[model samples]
Target: MPYLMRAEPYDASIGAVRPLFFSDLGFTSEPADSPSNTYFVRRIETPLAVRRSLFSGSAIGGYSETSFGSATLANDDGKLDWLSDLDWDGRLVEILYSPQERPALADFTVLFSGAAEQLVPGDEIEIQLRDLLVLLDVPASRGQFGGTGGVDGTAELRGRDKPWLIGRRRQIEPVLINAANNVYMVDPAGFSSLLAARDMGVTYPAAVGDFASYTALVAASLTGTNVATSKTAGLIRLGQKPNGRFTIDAEGVKVSGAWVYRFADLVRHVVTSMTTVTGASLLDVSFAAFNGLQPAVLGYWCDGSSVPKVRDVIDQLADSVGAYWGFGEDRLLSLGRYDGPAATADFEFTERTIIDLTPRPVDRRMKALKLGYRPFGVIFTADELDRVNVSAADLEAFQNEYRWTAVATNAAAAGASLLATEEEGKTLFDTEVAATAERDRRLSLFSAKRKAFDVVVPLTPGLTVGHTVKLTDSRFGLSGGWRGLVLEIERDANDETLKMTVQG
Candidate 1:
């Protein structure tokens, strides 16, 4: 197998990105051209190698540890001296492999592709690459406001027309009314008291994109009264009326406007709007897989104090609905529901291919995990019946109200505990029925055991994380095949070994 490497560096002289190709086929000899499938690349003798680490965790809310590793190239002939004049940051670098024995193959398998972060020139050139997901790290505001010219979320949108919040969304109380602009500068922190009052039964004030009127003075005065038992029920009812300038909806309130986005649409907005380090725009993000999952209505409030990152919005949306997300080999964002394994195995690793395999069972057990949304201060505990369990000492919190079910269900699926974790401080679910449905979903996926493994095998070309692998190991058991979801993959040019973490 011969490896082909391609690097695209921005050439200031040409005022455009220039692509350079290198190969490991010719050493200590003159450069020669060799065909790799349909494309012919230059083969040079100098040392060239790459190490890549990729993670596409199969579980919703699962964390991925990403490192694209480094690529070292030979520069002994000074033929690569021109690289010093080019910008390395955000340039494209890719590795492709083709087996000579498999000449029938028409294309080289793209082993890795990412943005080159740095270049250290010497006899050997070392280029550091970073995952493309880093593109979404930009601040999540539609536009900046107050201090300087900011993003205007209402500006004509590109791609899909789904409206998204310019900043954070909260259960706001109008502290100041800009009667001149018909805008309400809200006190986002004021609603906690009303939500914490169990008797208030705080209703979603109005339809989305509509403003509800209220007064800060009236809300503050009613805070101390017991709306459930006080004979002054009439006075307590005054707090829920709309006499303020705040825009209100079932999701929350925004200062100047409302953006009630569907779960999938919000995810797409953050993804498509981001610009990658390579100056590549992700305007073509694929959402066909995303729209197939369970849909929910989600929104947020944006203020000077609370600007979100694009990655954060995607994660929050995915985690809220038991979905997983990652960039695919196509370099586009992909999302899927974490309900179960893929319907069919992508490939099989049996005795013929597997070198070694070992089971790694999680031992940590939990008695209870408590979580709460910050806004409503409603707390719920998910308890697991086990022989040994730990207490809910670490309290988890979320920004949105309706994420308890997703969190709990995903926790249970991850083998953290047989029961889903609970939130205690904030209530994301507004109705008992909704809360119960979330709890039931968590219960259905609960399990006392989690199956995971570390597998060692020869280089598996075209293998990507999140793909299913059917394993058959006669050494451990019968010849029956077992399906497992690929979570993480590690491989280097120094060896043919591919290390993977597989969960079933």
Candidate 2:
């Protein structure tokens, strides 16, 4: 006997609570002028694809194998089709309840039986079920529309299925034209037409009679456009003044005072080449005339209050564009303090003169050191040698004792012969006697030669005053000692000398 059991409620906060489905949300409105009759409704659609479970079960009846010659068993397959359509009724719940604000949806959970006791006898279950629905709401203000600025209006609401309709109608406004109070009353179309006509070379018309003549003259001076009222009177007039004067109310006004008249004079006198008369040329002429006018006139027009009244008119004329008239391109006219035909006086010639008498001569054999070349030795003559008390023997001794030669091949032979023949046979007394006799003979010959020939020795070529040259091969005294210069180069009447002024 089985006892009955009751099913208990599960916590909705857990995963077991079920969810509800929502179908649509939107708005409707009526026209303001015909609120009772005019109606409009907007539809929003939501379609959700249902999901299927992946698992199924099958059952089979048991049979005896001994009686089984040709018997077959049937199979039973069961699936949970009911779980696929599990409806969710409380899927979307509004939390904020403001009348003007749009509704907000809350989240939900599934609810189901947990134990097997919840099922009836012989019942089979294969899958679990759950659901969720999309939620949408229309704001109360947009759902019902009225008028703006007394014009009837209507709008349709939409939901999640048609999101483009939200807040779109409120974003439009009308544009107004010519609404400012300070605008002028001139006809825009007529002003544009006048500008077009002017661009097409049409001139403004003048009034009648003398007033028209005066106005036309003034306008002609300002801009080079002529306007005559009557077709019979030509707009342009040309004539030559033989008397160069016009009787105007018994007063004389120079025609040069008027820029237009002066410009005409310039056109005739200077700018004869109409082919070269361009806008820039006309502007240059106008600026020149304007600058050349009286300072009061110039100051009144150009606001140069600081310029002097008695400014030089020729200075202004020299600055003008056509001031070079009648002058060749190479010839320029001066107008300031330096003005005159440029002087062409010839350069004068005084007598071709020379000053400071002195002597200069050329002699190639003088042995004077030329400029930029250094001399190996300087020579002094005999008269100059007397300034220093050096005798001729002193210089000859230096030259002979300091003269050098490469070691000779026969030097060893000569030395051997001398030592063997002379040195081997000598007693001390005989050697001394022979050396003294030879020395006496040399002294006597040197003294006689010094007196008879006045033999002056040449200066050591590489030695200079106060400088020394080494004597490595001395015939007498120690070798490798230095010889010194005693005097500088000088010339006597007949010979050159470097006297032995000192010895080292």
Candidate 3:
């Protein structure tokens, strides 16, 4: 791991790029995680990373720590004299030494607002500049000095891939796509038409390449030989007039108030609909294939009023396919996933890959699976919505199939557990099969967590979340075997230790 730290804040006022000259500074960012855009810095001279687009707001955020450490500064004149020209808001604090592979050393990492101290001469003038984290919360005036202004009004609150930003005391959310009224259309006409529509807006083959296109992938998983028009469910309600535009809080439109989609068409439609949410493209796609992931078809609803966040929608949809979706550098705009074979025990690990390991016990695995399908119309005036649920015909086969199987739902309350919500897979019958497939994939050695652990290893460059990794262990009968998905990675840039949450 080569040591590199650089802070370049654009000076929108001057119309040029200026690099911050840091006596010392460091930054850490995780584009893969939720709210992937953020950084922390402490510096000696001037702040970097500022932009006028964000006026009165310093690009640098702040953090403080006490009861942990101390810091003293020498004046710029290079003497024991009091510190001079103190501009704490955006200056990079320099580090004389940075040690690599040392998790305990915090020399070249971000700072915390806890457990620390800074000492300056009595005569010295000190200024406090914050890191970008604190910068998001600007203009803290208005409260009568107790100083806890509920939440900085100007601050942008984001989750998944959407910004839950406030305007006039209300949340303005990204819009959701309505299938009947979206940029893409549902064609009951089958394969060629479907492919044509997918490539319609394309100017280059690479731009709309067939490589892992969700449409192409779902086509592979198509249950029938071709599109079945009689079973296809069309839209009952498109949305408000300005289709594809964003809206505030909203719910998925009822699926034509009925289930008419051929199972194959339903899967195809939902997968295709997802790709239309703006900025759903990937930064880079691969020619390689991997395991534990198969090209999957997922079912979801798209409301016409607002455009949903691309990464967020893909994430929720990917779950249906036992796949993953998010950015690499993880900008608000981007998507990625691995759809291939069942998990094969690969990527062997030993002392070299495993830094710290802890074992945990998993209580139960579902033995039976009952997926409930709620129809589009007529909410139950009766006590149970279960009365009308469409059930999978093959629940018993699952019990005879898996090793440590538990019912997907309790038998008496069957049908509701997996299909608990009114998800718009209006494609009936086979949704049960899709849901069951998700369950089987989850029960796999790479997907199941009958054996699990938390391991802190060096950052493996290309490792993305939701991908499978093999852990060789003999204690839990995992000597000649053991593999699991990388559920979460706690990236520690300052400490240089990447902690991976494993499940299998």
Candidate 4:
């Protein structure tokens, strides 16, 4: 299908923005869009995120300042100036492109992040539209006409995305939660309270859509009590949120709520929640079940002092199930797990439908495993008065399997040490068992490789990232049904086909 595209520069400080130009030359590469990886730019002292490319093919037009081909901003392009306001680092150069060809801009659907710093000169002023935004325009370099005196080029225009209300974020001072901090039930309400505590407003439906009223939610480490109660606790950071969702103006914290069921739950919630989180609007809040789907009833709580950022909460939630999230379809957020339905081989692809394919070598660093155990089974027990007290140890023989084992250890890994976190289960044996199970799970998928291919297939319902696809060829050792998680899918406007990246 032919798609209509628009690229506009919007400023959150201003009301609305109009597209200065639209290009068929755009090639957007979104490696991942979940909160953990949806971060767009890396500033001067910051590290780079991913390898980005330019918007090749055609030139953009319409602005009077530099007629689609001007190198310098001789005339004031207010939006460009606004982005420059962020110094060298910037997100104001956002483009809202939609399939909808409408008169009013409010109806636009998908968001397009504008460009990175322009290295080469030309009319090639870049704008990024990515999981956040994507762009890096460079000229043919030489053979161009000069103004008059000497050879001149557009100064390397560097800027990041102007702050948008949706993904705007701020980081709280770090809080260590080792049984020494404030505590509360980090529920939708408790989470909202953290936002309120930060002077940010918290919004959610009175009744949780797909969530339950389960008693004894997860214990916390932020306050007083030790058990799963509101009295006292603390929290720890399971994962980190990217830099995008930090800033908010006087509006404080604007949150919309939604509920999704398990079986199809955490992955969908993390992906759609971050990407499609339209300002104050969240997923449908109707009291709908997963359509009679008897999936696991889910709700999460944590000490805000530890799991502070919104993305961190989502990341930690999904991490509990051995899953991590990133963007896939057109920078749409995605959450993928190491375990899914096994497809032994059938979904094969041949040279007829596959133009070319590239398989990435497994990065052991990305999937390192270090199982841990309590040297001596011990833990903190709560007293009758709700105070935390480190109880005694049981030195019983043959009580458990192996007392301790470092099954998946890599001694070369930056000076390895202990791999386990302190267990807080009711029984010391139960805690040790839980720790061992997690260790084995991580060992199974230690060698993971994400592959990308240029295919003639369209990215239909079954062909998106996170779906299973099979490959059969003597080259890729495809005798078995090697399943790979689709990491990215991009439509080639020129080829009129789709390209998919998958990780197995």
Best by lDDT: 1
Candidate 3 regions off by >4 Å?
6-10, 15-312, 329-347, 373-449, 473-481
Q: TM-score ranking from best to worst?
A: 1, 4, 3, 2
lDDT of 3 by residue, 1-504 (tens): 223223333445556443332232444445763224334333333211111111011110011111112233224454423233232333333222244543222443432121111224433213232322222122111111121211111122112121111001011122222222221112211112111110111111111222223233223321211221111211011112321122121122123343322222232233333343232332323202311133322233332223444333333333334333332323222222323223774355775567888876543433344333211211212222122231332122211212222234333223323422211121111234555555444333222225567877764444534467777655566677577766555544345556766666
Tens-digit lDDT string for candidate 1 (1-504): 677677889999999998777776621212343433334234333322333333233333423334467777778777777788899887788776665644332446777777787888877778877756666667764343232111111222222111233222334332222222222332221111122211112333221121222332223333222121111110112233332222222233222233324455556545544443231333233354455444334444443345567777666555444555665556655655544357689988888889889887643333333333323222223321111222233222212243342334344444555443433323333334444453444345433344678888887777767678888987545278777777677765557668887776
User: Could you estimate the TM-score for every candidate?
Assistant: 0.66, 0.12, 0.40, 0.40
Which residue segments of model 4 deviate by more than 4 Å?
1-4, 11-14, 19-21, 25-122, 132-308, 327-334, 340-348, 358-360, 363-390, 394-464, 477-483, 488-504
The weakest ten consecutive residues by lDDT in model 1 span 227-236
Model 1 TM-score, 2 decimals: 0.66
lDDT of 1: 0.48
Q: What ranges in model 1 sit over 4 Å off? A: 26-67, 101-105, 146-170, 173-182, 185-247, 250-260, 274-286, 363-439, 446-448
Cα deviation of 288, candidate 2, in Å: 1.9
lDDT of each: 0.48, 0.19, 0.31, 0.30
Q: Model 4, 301-390: lDDT tens per residue?
A: 221222223444444334333443433324333334445334653245654556567665433332244433322111111221112221
* Winner by lDDT between candidate 3 and candidate 1: 1
Runs off by more than 4 Å, candidate 2: 1-259, 262-265, 268-276, 279-290, 293-504
